[model samples]
Target: MMSVAPSELESPETRLAPDTPWVCLVWNDPINLMSYVTYVFMQYFGYSREKAESLMWDVHTKGRAVVNTGGREQMERDATAMHEYGLWATVQKDD
Candidate 1:
């Protein structure tokens, strides 16, 4: 059998493309209230009340929600902001 090179074993992101859009995700936590999460989304992201509530519900029931999507740097910034608001957050390339 042929052997593969180290360079060939790239992550999905690297193999797909470098400019793939990234997303900031907020995870559910026991401490933060659902209303507070909804409020944060409305205030920080300027989402409509209904939209904010929907995302908050997603976090509550689904365990996580995509709070923002854009470039990697922007997604990182969004994740940091969520952290500042005391929400669990992380960034990853969009599938």
Candidate 2:
């Protein structure tokens, strides 16, 4: 019988590097108004009304919006911030 080391069990390329970028996606929801979505974007991301509204519109018309992109940790924080603001959000690798 042979045993494989833990590191050997995983593919090297599958590991997430420390500096990889991630995106925070805000998804449209029936309960949240468009204006409220814009407000959340501005309040949490410091985006101007124009930018916030643009992202909100994307979420409305496209079904989702990538509100922000940054390092994995930052994107996670942005997702958490959006959650705190009572909006639907998630983070994923920027691919």
Q: What is the C-alpha lDDT of each candidate?
A: 0.94, 0.89
List the candidates' TM-scores in order: 0.81, 0.78
Model 2 per-residue lDDT tens digits across residues 1-95:
89999888676666753457789999988899999998888887899999999999999999999999898888888888888888889999987
In model 2, the runs with Cα more than 4 Å from the true position are 1-18
In angstroms, the error of model 1 at 9 is 29
Residue-wise lDDT of candidate 1 within 4-90, one digit each (tens)?
Answer: 987777877787877789999999999999999999999999999999999999999999999999999999989999999999999
How does candidate 2 fare on TM-score? 0.78
Candidate 1 weakest ten by summed lDDT: 10-19
Q: What's model 2's lDDT at 63?
A: 91
**Candidate 2 accuracy as lDDT:** 0.89
Query: What is the lDDT for 2 in model 1?
Result: 91
